[model samples]
Target: MALLDAQAIHPITLPDGTVYRDTVYLKNVIDHPRMEIGNFSYYTHSGRREDTALILAPYLGHACRERLVIGKFVQIARGSYFITSSANHPMAGFTTYPFRIFKPETFGYKDLPIKDTIVDHDVWIGQNAAIMPGVHIGSGAIVAAASVVTRDVPPYAVVGGNPASIIRMRYSSDVIDELLGLAWWDWPLDRIEANLPALSSGDMTALRRA
Candidate 1:
């Protein structure tokens, strides 16, 4: 049998074969119009399956202009949530208070700049991490626990702390470029399984050969 099942709502199976219900494949569980989740991207949350989208991105409404795009093989730990562009008030004005929202006719903030939050392939976001509006997390980046990401994270970087900053790059520029070019996440399931040794060991030569 294949190890991964994209259609499974609860993706994680324990060593004893019991399904771990807290972990859900985002693509299968989320059906929000404003959210785009790639295959095998899972989030660990205690919320009901139907509320996965809402729990992941509370501010992203169906009518909202901003999108939350999460790529393949992304692992989001418990308590992590995305704060999208819709959460922002009018910062251009003197008062941040949204006076226009009270009136039903003028509720929309169409003038506010909207930018999609993008989490690229193979990113692992640690527990309690908060991804702020408009941040683009590059492929293979690792976001540390309880971090507040306010800026763009570079490819294969290890970022941590409030207003997350890059602590270190996982690989040298050349290697990162090569791995990005490889894009193993895009491979077919059989091919991916065949390259497990190279993937797990970070064997560039073997990956290239594969």
Candidate 2:
């Protein structure tokens, strides 16, 4: 319910020098009151969010929700697509009838089942990616551009390609596990700011120990 000032956050300036302003527009999905975007998130015109979502769209379509959870400090890029709903069709009989024509109470429209997706903190989703419903993206993961994510992405791993194959680990599995346990994104802002230099350097060791 509280509206934070967009100006207080830094703006994203495109290579063409165009600027985007609305924080709400940056996400393809959202919950409420959990957003913590950094300085340059941007969303193209084709993104949307559900509810109570936190987003950091440094490029485009930062956060997209589908009745799921996105943890703090996640970064998303431009041209990414997050799909939550599949178009409903009648199961009782074969009909191309419009949704309004069928009573929601009778056909189960009133109880359209939706699964919540979760994206943990400090994740990075690359450009032009697509995330399907009912999938969880773990903390500190990296999803490469144009990847089609059909399954859960493990924490601190790198995934890419049409079906999103694991390209490599950004760090050793042990290091990744340790960082997840550290959970630095949960720290207070002042504490995080004090360690900004190390965090920005991608020093997993320093971050984990900090």
Candidate 3:
């Protein structure tokens, strides 16, 4: 009923026995109140929660402190994580030590410039991928598994590898434009259910009619 809080890893099964979504935990690690997540999104800890034996195990929103807006129909695979601007510690100083962190006098969140991380509609961030802060992922983009995204991703781009780059665009510019125009994700639940067949079949004619 709301964005994820401290209680993460909630899975709801539909009448067809399909796993609706495993997430709702966006509020847990993010310090910003403006951060928002949408319906049917899976964003949370997986089996790694109990793996206390792993050394320095990773977690979602480990470096978060500011805005992170996720759009509807976004699929965030298990173990996927976000690296916020807070992780960008000052490494230019004489010593790469964060003295301010230990010293309360200068200790504050403003030490680093915070930038909002936005994931637009229909995005699929693969397992263990790291989305750095300030990254504006365009709609329909796909981030490959374990890839570390360091820049903005274009809409419908299929990107992978460390410091993620554009592997390919999912569709031609025209088709992409049409799909964006359709924006089925924004439609009401009843409309979506009514048009599910057309949507699943990628029927542009049916979509347009809807």
Candidate 4:
């Protein structure tokens, strides 16, 4: 079955029969309810390596309520980090100083608004990319290596560089609309296997007819 299907849960078993472990081999991440990693999606991290421990793919979660939701068929390269929205201080028009922190009660919902980071299906995030809080990456978007994503990414768009800018759209608007409508990622395992011909190649004609 596609990894992020309705039936999917944490600790999904991979093609290699390796189970998805949180932070370490299926340890801390499995326990954390806020984290939602899709099926067949994986992250590669670079840090101190220990064979027995659960590898740390840094979530960079904030103190307030923040969430990281990644979709199916997503591929995250090593060093990719998510900077959640909860960590930001009030800086709109006002000074970027933390004057509110001095008063313990000032850290209320009004001061730090809750923003969740969401990455949609079939996205690819390259190495050392930093996704800012409240950034909603559309389905089939490609984040270029070393990119700092500060805003929302459109579906089928390719973005790169610091403060990530749009490189290009992978397909024409019509094609993208069709693809999004199809939502082939939500197909069942049997149907996916059966439609391999249309899925693998850019058989838009066949896909459209299907």
Candidate 5:
């Protein structure tokens, strides 16, 4: 089954009895009793969305705009911030109030387009990390705590710092390629569960063959 379809089955019930099936509400505004959160996703009071897969930690924040897209098996630590949009200001000589009155054509807003931030599968965002807008975090990448990601991150690389820099790769390039080829997340949950023993045994060869 597709990830979205699989997620629709499990509904999350909030404190007020509001049910959040997934982030489907993000597609369009809805007035349901519950917040629709996706499968394997997690969020905190700070407005961070760890959806598109599993969220493994607490203390994260509310996702900036429900449009934040996280991929499968993502592990986001506490205090992480994923910002999707930025408030634009008038670049030309004009009034700043009633910002909506001046459209992109009127000012330089046209130059600044809204870009969606995407965190690909198997990503690990450390605690207190801040992901800026338009940044694409490649699959299997790791972002260190308190780091500020300003650019796209390469797959399987470890990055850290205020202006996040590549510290090193989590695994050898060949290993990363092999793991990507494995594509375990695509397996049926039931099948994966059945083979959990083999997977957990650190036998990549077995997993790949499976």
Candidate 6:
């Protein structure tokens, strides 16, 4: 049998046979209009299952223009959240406080620029990480705990700290390019399962052979 169930809300099963309810497959639980979640992307949160979208991105509203696109096999830890483009206050004016939002008719900053946040496939975001608006996190990247990501993260990069600078690249440029081309995350479940050894062991030769 396959290890993961794409349809299951709670995907993690403990060694003792108990289901770990805190972790949920994001695609199954999230139903936001402006958010796109890929399969097997799981999030660990203690809140109610129905509140997944809100908890993950509190600033993103139903009517917001910017979208949050998360790709397949993303592993987001507890207390991590996204501050989307809609959350930004106007910078052109003298004061940052929004004066026009007081009235119902004048509410919202619809005229502001909207940039969608993209988290690519196989990204692992650590606990309490805050991804700033419009940041494009590349595939196979690892974000360290409590990092404040304000810029784009390169693929296979390990990023950490405030403003989220790249600590190191997981693989060489050539290898990274090859891996990106291979895109193991896009493979069928059976194919992925068959190549588990190479994937987990980081055996590039075996992976290429697969």
The residue-by-residue lDDT of candidate 6 on 142-198, one tens digit each, is 999999999999999999999899999999999999999999999998999999999
Per-residue lDDT of 130-202 in model 2, one digit per residue for the tens?
8876678888899998999988889888999989988888888887777777777777666777787778898
Q: Pick the candidate with the highest TM-score.
A: 6
Against the correct fold, how does model 6 do in TM-score?
Answer: 0.99
Instruction: List the RMSD of every prediction in angstroms.
Output: 0.8, 7.1, 5.6, 5.2, 8.1, 0.6
Report, for every candidate in turn, its global Cα lDDT versus the true structure: 0.95, 0.60, 0.70, 0.71, 0.61, 0.96
lDDT of 1 by residue, 147-179 (tens): 999999999999999889999999999999999
Q: Which model is ahead, 1 or 2, in terms of lDDT?
A: 1
Tell me the lDDT of candidate 6: 0.96
Give me candidate 3's TM-score against the actual structure.
Answer: 0.77
Roughly what TM-score does model 1 have, to 2 decimal places?
0.98
lDDT of 5 by residue, 1-210 (tens): 322344342324678988654323221222122123223444332232334222311212233232456666666666676665434344455765546536765532434456667887767788889888678898889999899999999998999998999999977888888878876666777777666777668577777667
Q: After superposition, how far is residue 45 of candidate 6 from its true place, in Å?
A: 0.5
lDDT of 3 by residue, 1-210 (tens): 332222444544568977555443343333334457766555645444233111112222434466668887788777777765666677666876777778778765465677877899889989889888789999999999999999999998999998899999988999899989888888876778788889778787888999
**Residue pairs in collision within model 3:** 4-24, 4-25
How are the candidates ranked when ordered by lDDT, highest leading? 6, 1, 4, 3, 5, 2
Off by over 4 Å in 4: 1-29, 46-63, 92-110
In model 1, the worst 10-residue window by lDDT is 3-12
